[model samples]
Target chain A: MHYFDCCDFTIASEIAWPVSFPASREPEVEIRYRNLPTDLGEGGERGFRFHAKPNELLICVDGVARYLIRGGKEIWIEPFPHADEDSIVAFLQSSVLGVLLLQRRFLVLNGGVFNVDGEGIALVGCSRAGKSTLAAAFQRIGASLFSDELCAIKQDSSGRMMAWPVLPALSLWENTLIQQGGDVTKLRPIRPSIRKYLVPTHAKSLSPVPLTQVVELKDYHGDLLWKTVDVKEAITLVLGNTYRHRFLIGMALKDAHFLQSTALIQQSRFYIAQRHLTVTSEDAFFHFVRTNLAL
Target chain B: MKSIVWLASYPKSGNTWLRIFLENLFFATDEPCDINNLRSSFMSCSLDLFDHECGWDVSLLSHDEIDRLRPEIYTYIDSQWENVKYFKTHCAYSFTGSGEAFFPDEATKAAIYLIRNPLDVCISYAHHRGYSDYDRIIAEMADAASCLCSDTDQPFWQARQKILSWSLNVESWLSVEGFPVLFLRYEDMKNNPYEAFSRVAAHLGVNKSELEIRQAIKNSSFEELQKQESLNSFKEKPSRSKKFFRSGQNGMGYAMLSRSQVASIIANHGQIMAQFGYL
Candidate 1:
C-alpha cells in the first residue's frame, strides 16, 4: 500500500501506482484528497476528497479514504488496474499528463469535454458529434487549441476568467484521422463498434485562447444549417450534451463552484449546427465550419 | 377480476396521441394534456423502475437471460399493477419464457395498438434519433417484424424494429380470444380525430356524448399538447432537449426514402401495415 499525506488527511491503498506523476515542491495553493472505500459490485469502491484553504471537494466511495495530498499542478489519474508496464506508461502519458495540462479545476466525463470560450461560445454535442472533429479543423486553420477533450476554467487572483488545456491529445475517428492524414498506428482500440485514435496537439498550440463562440453539431436530413441561440437555450443544450455520468449531475447540482462555473459558461455565445446530411468526406464538415464559424 | 390495459406501439407511432385521447376522454378534465402526468397517472412501467426494484442488473444480463426474464418480469409486473393499469411496453410480440404467449395471461382491461407504415416509421426514427443510413434501418425493421411474427425472443436491431414489433405485439394481443382490442392507425388519427377517438372511447366502454368526445379530441390535438407547458418538461435525467412533438403529419417519411426502400418495407410488413390502413 502506498501512503500519501497532506494537510488533515492520509490514504493507503493496495492498488499500485501504474504511472508516476511529476511531483511539485512549490506551494501555491494546498488541497488534500483521500480515496474512500466502496462496495459497488465491480470490486471495491475507490474515492478521494480535495480540501483547499477555504473550500473542500470530498469524493467518497464505499467507506475507505486512500490518497491525501496537498494541491500541486492538478490531480492525475492513471486509469486504474493496469495489467502491464507499457499500458501503465501509456496511461501516464495519455491520462495523467492530460490532467496536468488542465490549467484550472474541471471534471472529466466519458473522456470528453464541454468547454465554453471566453467570448461565450459553448461547443456542445453528443459523442461523435464532431467536437474533436471541429477542434482539429480549427487547429489546421491556425486557431490555438486550448484542449482536445477536457479543459480547466478558473478565476485568477485578479478575478479574470481563464481556460486551460486538460488533455494533450484529441481522439479522432478513423474517418477523421484519414481526413487529417494522422498516423493510424498511434490509434488505441476503444471498442468493437467504432475506431478511435489519439492525436497529440502541438505544444505551441497549448496556450489558452479566449472562448468567443459555441457551436453544437447535430445530424439532420442531409443538409447543413446554422442558427444562433440565446444563453438560456445554450445552457440547456450544453447541459444536455455534457459528459452526463450519473454522479456528475448530482455533483453539478450540489457544488456551488461547479454551478457558478457552469453559469459563467452560460453567458457565452451558442449556436446549433445541423451538419450536412450526406458528406462525402470529413473535409466537407471542416469546410463548413471554416466558412461559417468566426474561428 | 382485475383488468390490465396495454398501451403499446412502435415508437413515435401515435402512442402518445392515443394516450392523450384516452386521458382527455376518461378523466373529463378541462385541464390541458400533460404527458408526464399522463404517464405517471396511468401507472406506466418502464425499464428504469424495473431495474431499481428487482436488482435485475439489466445492463449486465446476456441476451438469453433478457429473453428468459422478459416475460417473467412482465408477468410479475402485471400481477403487481393489477388495479386499473394502463401498461406501456416497447417489447415486440414474442414469448418471454412464460409460455408461448404473446401477452400476459390475465384478462386485458383493453388492448389498443397503433401502427404506421414501416417506411414512415423508418424515416421518422432515422431523422429523430440520428440514424445515419436507411438500409441498416430497414434491415432492423424487417428483423423486428419477423421476431414479432415468430413469437421468438430476440433483441431488436434498430429503433424502427422496436416500433414495428410494438405494433405486432399489439396485434397479437388483439388476436387473443376474449379480450377487448382496438386498432388505431396513425394516418386515421391524423386525418379524423373524432372518428378515431370515438372508436377508442367505445372500446374503453365509456359512454360519452359526441360533444364530449369532440372536446376530448380537441384537447388531445397535437397543437394543444405541444403548447401545454407540462408536456414540454421531462423529469428524467438526460432530458429530451428537443421538442418532443414534431410534425404530426402522415407520410412525411416519403420525402426522405427512395421509392424502392418504401416498396421494400411495404412488401415485408404489408399485411400488418395494411390491416391498420397504412397502405
Candidate 2:
C-alpha cells in the first residue's frame, strides 16, 4: 500500500489504479483513490474518490462523477448534467487542494494569520471586498508578501500551525494598481468582466512562516469599529468565508480538524473590524498593519 | 376613485425624480423625500409599506423567503389598495405571474416606461454604487447585455433578461387595446420637463396647470433630490469601506467612456433606445 502522510491524517490505499506512462516508460504521476471516513456525521458520511487520469481528472461522489478533460475548460458530469460548470471547477480546486490535499486541517484563526514572530498579518475577505488593496497596503510597509488569493495552513509535529505560501499574486482594480506603484505590463486581461488586474508580488525573500492570526476583512461602515471574537466564533466565520465546496472530505475528520484548528485560533486573538470607508493606498494599509499588529 | 399612477423605470433612470415631482405637487410640503415615511403615508397599502407595517412577521424571513411570499402578500394588499395606489418598480413588465395582478392586471394600470440610454444608465450605476474599478463595471454591463439578448427559455441571466424583456413588454402593452401606456424618455424629461410632466399628469387624470408642472419640475430637480435626506439615505448596513448612495448625475457616461465606447453602447441597446425616440 502506498501511503501519503500530511500531518495527523494518513491516506493508505492498495488499489492498482491505472497509471499513465510517458515515452520514457516512466509513470509521470501515481493515482490512488479510496472511500475514507470524513467523520462530519450526516454531511460527511459521503466519500470522495479522485483519479488523476492521463492529462485529465475525475472525481466521484454521491453516485455522480465529474470528468475534467485538459483541453476543454468545462467540466462534464454524468447523471447530474445540469450542475453549473464553473461552480464545479471552483469546487474541485478548493476541495482537492484545500481539504483533501492538505489532509483536512484548520489553519486560519481570529480574522488574521500571524507571521513567524507574529510580526506580519494577512487579511482575507470575500471577492470585491478589498483584500488585494489591503495586501498592497501591507506590502508598501515592507512586510513580506505570501499571497492574496489562496494560503495553505499546516500543523507541524510540534502542534504549531504554519501558513504555507501559495502564489504571490494580488488582484486589484486599475486605479488601485496605479496607486500601489504597480506596472501595467503586470496586468492580465480577465475578460468578459471589466476593471480587474492581477499584479504579482516581487517579494521572494520571504518563505512560508508560522501563522498567528486570521482577520476576516470587511468594509468600513459609518464609523471605525473593531471587536475581538472568541475562537469558536472565528472558526464559524472563517468557515462561512471559505471557498464554496460541493463535497467536503471525511465528516468526523473535518470536525476534529476544525476543533483543533479552533484551539490554535483561541490561543491567539480574533477580531471583527469596521474601518474608515476610504480607498487608502498600500503604504497606508501596511502602516496600519504595523501599528495594529505591533510588529 | 382617485387613480394611482405607477411611475416605473429601470434603476438610475429617474424613478425618484418622478416620485419627488408628484409628492411636491400633491403634498405642497418639502418634508423630505422619505420613501419609508411616504410609503406609510399615502401609499401605505403598497408593498414597501406592508414590509414595515407587518414588521416582525415579514422581516424575520430571509430575502428569498420574502420573495417567495411576495405574490401572496401582494394579493392581500391588492385587495386593500384596489382603488388608490401609486407604486414604483424597477422590475420589467409582465413580472406579475399568473393570477397575481396587484395593480389592475398590468393591463389597466398606467405603466410609464421611462427609457434611458444604456451608456448613461451604466455610468450612473457605476458611480451611484462603489465598484472596484472600470473593468468590474464593464463586466457587469456585458453580463446584463448578454442576459437581455438571450432567449427567455434559458435559465441563466435572470436579472439581465428581465431588463431586456421590458422593451418587448412595453411594445406589447402599447399595441394592446384598453390600459393606458405612456412612453417617456429620460433624455426628453431632462430636455423638456414641463412638456413631459404635463403629458404624464394628463394621462393620470390629474389637472396640472403650466405653473404647477413648472413647480413640480423645479422641486424635483436633481439638486433638490440630492438635498433631500431621505432620498439620498440607505437603510441597509454598509459593507466594508463602501456606501449606498454615492452620486446622482446625467451624462456621466460621456465623462467615463470614449466616443467609440459610447457608439458600442448605443449599438448594444440601440433597438430599445430607438423605440423610445432616444436616438
- Give the best candidate by lDDT: 1
lDDT of 2 by residue, A1-295 (tens): 4333222233232321111111222222222323333222232222123433222334443212243322112233342454433333223323333433323344422122324353335576544445666666766656666656555566667766566544344545666666666675655532212244545564343335666656666555234445667856877666655432222232224454565556557554655554543443345545555566565
* lDDT to native, each model: 0.50, 0.48
For candidate 2, the per-residue lDDT at A42 reads: 30
For B1-279, candidate 2 gives per-residue lDDT tens digits of 324455666666776667767776765543444432344223212322433223111222222333444444444445545564566655444333343433455324466667676677777656555554554445455444222322211111112223333344344445533456687878878888888888878877778677777876786676655454343343221233133334454577778877877776666556766766657
Candidate 1 residue lDDT tens string, B77-132: 55555455676555554454446543555635667777777777786666555566
Superposition error at A177 for model 2 (Å): 3.0
Quote fnat for model 2.
0.00
Q: Candidates' DockQ values? A: 0.06, 0.04
State the local distance difference test value for candidate 1. Answer: 0.50
Worst ten-residue run, lDDT, model 2 chain B?
B151-160
How many pairs collide in each candidate, listed in order? Answer: 24, 31
TM-scores for chain A over all candidates: 0.60, 0.58
